[model samples]
Target: MSKRLIVVFFLLLLLQPYPFVWSAEQVSALSKQPIKTVVTDRFETGVVLTKKVLLPNGDLYWMKRLEFTSDHREPYTFSIPLSGSNGTFRYVERLPAGNRWATIPVDTKLPQPSGFLQTNQMSMLLNASNFYIKNVQGTFEQQPNPLPINVIRTLDGYKIHVHFPQKKNSIAEIWGLESKESLVDWSSTPDLEAIWLAIDLQEHSKWSWDGYYVRSPQTYTPYSPNMFWRLPANYAAHSFIITGGSRAADDLGWVMLDTILPNQNREGYWETLPRSEWLWKDYGIGAGFFDTRFNTDIATLLLKGYRRYGDRHFYQAAEKYSYYLLAHIDHHHYTNYGESEGWLPADYSWKQPHKKTHVSLNHHLHEMNFLYEMYLETKQEFYKEMADKLLYGVKNTKSMWIKPNHDLHYAYLPNGKMGLQDYPFLTYNDLVESQSLFVKIYGRMDPDLAELMANKKQWMDQTGVKGYRFFPL
Candidate 1:
């Protein structure tokens, strides 16, 4: 035969389902008998076949143990009032509750299966999925149940009814179903595909609401809808526009360029706003806070915009933000910094005047890393010079947060003090953040320092010191 003819012959054979036919008399005989039950009970019990032994190394251990086994089964089906096309009675939901976005209630009732079947077969095929009998003769069987049984294929799975010659209201279970439910092919249904597309389009359309871009409607608060602007909402917006192709890029990017960035300060720093409609303030509840965390994030966003659009304005904006943060380094009035020595205040400005004197090792590492990023971006000697000074200040100052063994002091007060009582114990978070920067900075600037940081990272990983723990040596 030709290769094409041979291929067609095999394809036809593959499409055919296995034939398991029986005579009318045989069917009637099987129908009268109960489909044997298949039960799969799962428990945490394990067999300790051997006794515990004490080792020479002062360790107690079990010799041999047998773990529990599990069998996937068709869960028990409760007879509910199913809707029927022929019958007048039907099922309906009296109450509907839940978010439409998460779940939608189907008000229309579905018609019940036309027929039911009881089976004695080891395995049964229904709706292209398989159902297998898990137990036979009161013992769980690894193989499927034997043939000569009645079975009905339904939307959920094959429903097997039980029958006893002399007993009524008898229950027989068939567990360990190979297939439990029908899998819907959404792409095969044009209407469902269209609905899915509409939902996706609608979701993307609502990315930006009111004036600023938002992650979700759940994050939306009338008083401060733009609060996430300080967080990662702006970055998410920029990323959405950049990665989401022409439609998102044209609409959202245009709004960002024309409306959003222009409304902010000339130095390119966004002020904290108490209300969505309120004007930006310099020194009140939400004002004049140059945080390294916030500025660095915004600057990175602007830098991404510059790289994508080849817009000089974005670069200038990013540079201006870095400069603004750099200017507030000492912040002499509120911060307790001498002429030659100073720590990077966590927050500096009108709102957190008192906290300006409170130095944090974590925040200090963040600022230093931000400065280094700025240096890399602009290649400005001034930024590199500031980075050098920060490196020196963190290491040499009276509030040296890192120790010789690479253990980190959580935070430092203005009095150059840090430990568990006043500050916090070293955490995995603190170690990773500070050590990451240290490795990065030292790798580029000083190899010796980098080696030390590498050792610290190794020690931390090996020791398994996590949570709020003493500085792991």
Candidate 2:
């Protein structure tokens, strides 16, 4: 066949109907003797056996697999052998009160078939004496006491029902017999609610740290010892919400806030103290300063916590950090730093000063946006004014806007012309972080801007880009 025709044929085959297998005599016998009562260890029992009913074209006809199980503590095994070309079934072990069962798949296409066939050649050992006898081809043996059985046929398989006494409350096991040496092992007992409850209890217990919330799996180290300030912020926020804003929750928040505030302030620009020998020797970044991406997240979280809780201590700490960010703002009209403008080269270490003063827009936007929220939540005029100036400054600067590209929506560049020479991917996490700050800021001043951001959010979701990590560098 030509390549295109071959492809089309394969596509058509993919769309073809599934095969079905069943016997008309077996169906008639099942319909006549609807149910069977068997003397077994269990007070109540039910069995369903299913086989595929196929059409001449090798496509499936509607059917369901037979299901069988007992609710008693009797060690029993059952098996059904397929005398025809295609046959499959499943056995189940059910719980006491509910309709939940543990299932096992049984396919009669195993390599060996001698052990599966019965000695009498009339019955399949469902479980010792409890047998489903095919007296002849496609015909079941007539019983003195015919049982009421429910047979349901569906697109995938068939369901045959065999009923037992309903008074017994014990659990049972089920097995599918292929032969003496081969059987489908399936066993189960019901405790559904208790299982879920136990899991939930264990999860909560592991997630809790001395009545204060940690994400999951209890840890020895406190939240503050984790290095990054964002940890404490998230822990505090989540704990408070989980506890429904209780006093104890508020206290934990305060404790974490108190612990993180000092470190944040030390990292801020206002701290004029000399660098510790270790700080300079190890980090190589100037005295006790937090200029990393982590610092920005920490600051944002702190500000958010303060806004939500209305704590004076948190507000004061936020104010100190805000002041630090403000001090570093370049107030120049054209270029923030003249010909020395543009992004700081990736190779350029913060420890050694370069001629250019390229600031990451992500950091700048986040800090300014957070400060703006603080202003709105607290009605601080200075914050509002500072935020406006920062926004205006960013809009006029050519260094801040990135050029469009195939690899990324926009790229942060040291110089506008270079256009993502270093990094090329637009990551979902980065976009969410940036957009979150943008929404928070715009929501306060311009609702229209926030709405536009919301529309962009739809695009992010529809393209399935919100969760993917797409960074090229």
Candidate 3:
């Protein structure tokens, strides 16, 4: 062959797509074998098998590596999946060492001995004083009262473990913090029994200091730099916590509701930015525009509040938000694609022409869930019809579902674009989340949908960021 032709041939070979195995049977077989130095078809952007060790107990540890080959980072912002039957998941920088692990529990029902009403496992970390120990350890003998805590790395965040003397009532505060630089000396214990009895309660039991709700240590605050002003979303979330049952839930619940009522706009939508208008204005997004995501979240809280207090007002507020969402549905594509415009601008009345609409499968699913719940409560056909339409659109969209084999199918997106040429390369977690949502909402509706659901679940069980066991591509 000519030298030029040989070069062309080698380039053709290099251009071959990543040869991922796309079947459960094949992946399961490969997983049982010993590790290899180099994994076959190991795409740089995908999971690469580095080593597999077989323990004496017959358990295998597959050390797979994932350095995302592409630049898309949004969906792959890593999170440890909820394992077993527990309804708990956490955001960790890395996976845990053992399969048997438990997330540090958060109890909204119990008040901190002296901190704030809106305190959780995370919020308590704001004040170092909340980190107290009953029985001091020898190693921490030289350490100060707010001792250096031992923070264990988990899939999402730190699992703090303060070593107690192993006695029935002995305890040490601040096992460790992820960032030691932020540690401060905190020394106050209002109710020592309550604080020591429940290790999970991090924030001490003092309602709002001055005016601002005490912020949780785990709360992501980049969006709103100021922790002082309580946004509607935060207020609603804090209110939802107290509805469960606590000695202070009744008083705190009324306080949250009273604070939330006045924020409602003239059209009944709640304004989230009485204090942080410039925070959003920088994005060309208007200040008073109500967010569907926040409203949906708050609506659920209101529904819970209604259930807890048996108040007609809570029910009415939830229904009001639901109606606002229904009215904002993108009428343009309601028939064409069965999609509802997911977001609206602050000055939508005047800025409608300039605002470019947005929608995604996940958003649609979330809205459908809210609408379905409303339909159940009101027995309204309108909400049911809306939910059914979204389900039907997802099921019928040819571009959305990809079935590689009889037992394996998953979903992806060209991000809902038209006339896309390349096969969409997307995140494994996104597929799991969206496809699982599809299965959850529509699995029982039809046999065909149920089969698709089963396939996706099977695929998800085997799929991971380290390496997808079986992928279509």
Error of 2 at 220 (Å): 24
Per-residue lDDT of candidate 1, residues 199-255 (tens digit): 221112222211242222222222222112322225435554445332223333433
List model 3 lDDT by residue over 1-473, tens digit each.
12453344234335633112235554453344322133434442443233333322232222223333343322221221111121222211123562221233332211112222111122222222221111111010111233232334455444433221222221122111111111111233334323222322222222221112333222222232222223345442344354223322333443345336545555546654432233333323343445555566567667666555444556667766665665555332333343431221121211223233334433455566666766666555566666566556555553344456323222122234422221122223333434444455455334434544455555555553243423221
Q: Against the unseen true structure, what C-alpha lDDT does each candidate score?
A: 0.38, 0.35, 0.37
- TM-score, each model? 0.40, 0.36, 0.41
Better of 1 and 3 by TM-score: 3
Q: Give the TM-score comparing model 3 with the true structure, all chains together.
A: 0.41
The model with the greater lDDT, 2 or 3, is 3
Q: What is the C-alpha RMSD of each candidate to the true structure, in Å?
A: 28.3, 27.7, 25.3
Alpha-carbon lDDT of model 1: 0.38
After superposing candidate 3 on the true structure, give the runs of residues whose Cα lies further than 4 Å from its correct spot.
Answer: 1-230, 235-258, 274-284, 330-353, 401-443, 446-473
Best by TM-score: 3
Candidate 2 stretches with Cα past 4 Å from truth are 1-251, 265-289, 307-310, 331-357, 397-411, 417-459, 467-473
Better of 1 and 2 by lDDT: 1
Q: Whole-model lDDT for model 3 versus the true structure?
A: 0.37
Per-candidate clash tally: 11, 35, 24
Query: TM-score of the candidate numbered 2?
Result: 0.36
